[model samples]
Target: MEPLFRLALLRPAIAQDPDRPSVELAQQTDFQRALSAASGAPDPRTGLRRVVGEYVAGPL
Candidate 1:
């Protein structure tokens, strides 16, 4: 999105290969759709924990 260009950063995105180190440059439509879908996302941790297992927070 425009914000990324301003910050000299690419849009946040998920890579196709989970084990690969890569950042997908989110297309405009994808960004907009993500924003809309997450507008009211609740209990996100529940779903995340399912895939990634018990949470472990690093020292602050």
Candidate 2:
């Protein structure tokens, strides 16, 4: 069928080797740590909102 042929073309080809080290490295890296290190700062949108909201909310 034409649809089956199109679906086959769209499918991602998986690597034949299942135990690649690049896959392990991708899993091991902490996404949050990587983001923080790259920016040298906490994410501004969420962090800024929390800081401003705390001032408005007052001591709990």
Candidate 3:
């Protein structure tokens, strides 16, 4: 939950950046893939935790 909140806060900052479209698109794509993977897990809580962990470990 905490990590997710941090990501929510960080997303807008990324979106506001005007100098790096490629990097921004890559980040958004990674996030979407993480979300899709999480949705496929059998347990919602475990899935979300794994997604958040992966997100935090990824480029920020």
TM-score of 1: 0.23
Return the clash pairs for model 3, or none. none
Cα RMSD to native, each candidate?
13.6, 12.3, 11.7
lDDT of each residue in 1-60, candidate 3, tens digit only: 699999988777534447655544444576777787788888867888888897888886
Candidate order by TM-score, highest to lowest? 3, 2, 1
Best by TM-score: 3
Which model is ahead, 2 or 3, in terms of TM-score? 3
Q: TM-score of the candidate numbered 3?
A: 0.40
Q: Scored by CA lDDT, what does every candidate get?
A: 0.51, 0.57, 0.74
> Weakest 10 consecutive residues, lDDT, candidate 1?
51-60
CA lDDT, candidate 1, residue 9: 62
Give residue 58's error in model 2 in angstroms.
Answer: 0.7
User: By TM-score, is 1 or 2 better?
Assistant: 2
Give the candidate number with the greatest lDDT: 3
Model 3 regions lying over 4 Å from their true place: 1-28
